[model samples]
Target: MDPRKQRSRDRLYAAALELAAEHPIADLTVTQLAGAAGVHRSTFYEHADSPQALVEAALTAELDVLREELLKDRADAATAVAKVTEAVLRHILIHVDLYRRELADGAGGLHAMLSRHFRGTTETLLERGRIDLDVTVEGMPPARVADAAARFLADGTVGIIDGWLRHPSARVEDFLRVYAALLPSWWPHSPAA
Candidate 1:
């Protein structure tokens, strides 16, 4: 990628995140994001086709950073999984405002997109032996179990998260408790239990 273009995209991503934090995703516009990033309206078009596309790019970039954070300082399989799951929940909590806005607006299947990204990251971890799993998917080959597990967990996780987002009383701890329930044997039970 060209350095200058990369810089512009990076600015746009950062600006999108900032605006997302402050305004509803549906209410945000390309002009607002471009102005926030100190770039021209045409420059944003050079990077993304629409405001939703820009937001998706920003969210994807944030998720990439979170993936790196979760994979750092590798540990046992259970510990690693616990860390990754917790990091995901915490990341969502930190961006709860944006999530609520997007979910309420029906902003283009964000949960599905997140699930896809998570599945890809988890599959990579499994293939690289970063996360060890003893279970196989149905009668499938052991080599492909990682792919299957990733799909199951990623889809399930996103579904649970979307439910929590819709619930008015759901908090970060509530979300974490639901996630932790999936891996009860991984760590000490939470206070909620």
Candidate 2:
């Protein structure tokens, strides 16, 4: 939490974002990132072992700002989907370049890491809520419902964001409509997925 470390990370994140504008997550490397930030290669390695890690850190940095400023609202269970839709649309709109660089690359992108966190976040919410969640493991007992729901929500969000990233200027309503119509069948008890 040192201010110096924060500054270094900020510089690296900025550099990564800039380079992602031209290149992509898979194409960008730690050496290029360090050089872009004017930091030594060792410094970049001190923070992250690979370009994926660096990109993850950069994405986490950007998401913090978005979560605080844009996704601060918490709604009731019935309306939570709306809040999520708004927040996700804003996230995609605000960071489409980063999304494209990280998530649009299929499995090797940032979506894997970010979607795991998203699933975990949803699990926390379900644990603290009154909703009848149906999260379940592949072959385990019923204690894993929250984690399972988290994965569904996380991957669903990623897919939506991936589509939106391909069409950055589309209306939020359009995405929300498409998602609302398609997501229920993929939920826990939605007719065998």
Candidate 3:
């Protein structure tokens, strides 16, 4: 990763995102992306093979920021989860326009990237022991339990947030309150058995 090459790649990604915001990904062309990026078409080829790859790279760049932000604060499992959820929603709201198009169409590219990123982040949290899963399910090891919990949470939370993004009626704080209540401590019965 040479510095100049990295800058060119960044420019290509930025150009693709800008074009994507104005036109559908299906309609965008490599020449247009390269032109906007101020790079030659050959340069773009060095970075990404296709427009979809550019879209995924751009989206991953954005999501990576959210992940880094979540990793900043040290807290208990419940608190960390809450912070991660809040950060995720805030990031989405900030880029609602880009996400609206991606989430709406784009051949499920956005959904796939989001699911993978969110789930991987959740798995990282579990691996770091930042989020403790006290409850043990029968026949499942603690680590396996954590993995399953992370998967479920990642899927359910993303689904819920995606729905909210589509409708966007509730305040962020209101949604967060509901999300926090899903934590083990907020549950009526002890989560651990």
Candidate 4:
């Protein structure tokens, strides 16, 4: 796509996410997004196949932002765990509305968001962490460890976020922090020795 068109789509998705923060995705419409973004309706569709598509795009954009930001934020050995944990915690805090709204209706929104971003990203994080924790982790292959960690984190964390969303006003930080502590416990040495 042309640079100008790419920027327009980016703006439209940005508008869509901003709107989604205040309202449920089900409540949002193309017209509202187009107006908020100052782009034509046709132009909005050029960026995404639908409003949900826009959500997906917006989230994917955030994931890229997070990947760069989190990885660059720190690179030390002992710190990566805390870094990933804190990154996820802070992310949920910032987007609590969006997260809660996603889970309001039996977690349909949660499912969508997972399919959109966290699933693959979780796997990637697991693999990366495993590689980094080589001395602490022993001999597991990166793919297996990554796959397990991804599945474990995605499933359990999604459920926890759903609960937090259901409550809406609760502080989930401590809850997520403890959960983060469990992650490194999976390191092979912790289990074998």
Candidate 5:
């Protein structure tokens, strides 16, 4: 990536996070983002089509890094999983206001994107046999079971996070405890274990 382009993207991402913390990205205009980012509208267009797109790209980039690290860390699967999950939760907590606004409706774009990203990540881990499932449904093929499990974990986790964000008094530690308790017994790195 060109240094100039990278700088522009960084500016855009910073501006998006700042602005999104105050207002829902859906209600923000591209012009507002361009002005906040100190980039021309054309420059903004070069990166993302909408403010929501830019915010999603910026947020998911962090998650992608965590996912890559999780795949590379082989010394302790359980610890690695716990660390990554905590990192993810902390990341959201850091931007709690932004997430609260974005996910206020429960079925917002951010929620859907997160669900898709998590579902894909879980599917990858399962396909690689990085995670084990201790329970099996009757008469279901392994692949079918894996898909169902992935969707369940992804959607359930996202839904829980969304609910937590919607509640103003919910603490991160409390959410983590609940999340860990809800994980399947075979899941590695469960804080509850």
Candidate 6:
């Protein structure tokens, strides 16, 4: 990555985060984002196809760091899982308003992107034998089972987070409790347990 290009991307990401905190990503225009980023519209296009795409890229990059930490070879899987999960929850809490606005209309682009990200991360962990499925359906192939498990975990977790974000009285601890209760007993850790 060229230094100039990297700087431009950083500017765009920072601006996107700031603007997203104020308005829904779907309502944001490329021209507004480029102006906020202090970059030309052409430069914005060089980085992302749309304002939503830019915001998704910027947010997911932050989540990817925690995913990497969760994937590392730690001695205590439970502790590592708890730490990473808490970190991720804290990250979401920090941007709660942006998430609330994006998810207000139900399963939209941000929700789908989050589901895909979670599903991909789960699949990678499964492939590396970092996690195990506690239940298996009769006559189901291992590959299909893995895929189903990934989708289930991804969709269910995202759904729970979506509901939590929408609820007026929802607290981080309450969300964590529900999240921990919903996980399989075989899961490495429970943040609220």
TM-scores of the candidates in the order shown? 0.77, 0.77, 0.80, 0.73, 0.90, 0.93
Candidate 5, which ten residues in sequence have the lowest lDDT sum? 184-193
Q: Which candidate achieves the best lDDT against the true structure?
A: 6
Candidate 4 — number of clashing residue pairs? 0
Q: How far is candidate 5 from the true structure (C-alpha RMSD, Å)?
A: 2.0
| Cα-based RMSD of candidate 3 | 4.2
Best by TM-score: 6
lDDT of 6: 0.85
Residue 140 in model 4: lDDT: 77
lDDT of 1: 0.75
Write out the backbone clash pairs for model 1: none
Question: Over the stretch 1-193, how does candidate 4's per-residue lDDT look in tens digits?
Answer: 8999988987897798789889888788899899999999999878877787787678767656765665565455335535555566566677778877777665565565654455665555555653343322469776675666556666666666666567646565656554555554443212111
How much RMSD separates candidate 1 from the native structure?
4.1
**Cα lDDT tens digits for candidate 3, 88-151:** 7776776676667667643467777787887788788767766656678899888787777767
lDDT, each prediction: 0.75, 0.68, 0.72, 0.66, 0.84, 0.85
Off by over 4 Å in 4: 72-74, 126-149, 181-184, 187-193
Ranked candidates, highest lDDT first: 6, 5, 1, 3, 2, 4
Q: Could you give the C-alpha RMSD of every candidate to the true structure, in order shown?
A: 4.1, 5.0, 4.2, 5.0, 2.0, 2.0
lDDT of 4 at 168: 46
Per-residue CA lDDT of model 2 for 138-182, tens digit only, reads: 777665655666677789878886776677476788876777776
TM-score of 4: 0.73
For candidate 5, report its TM-score.
0.90
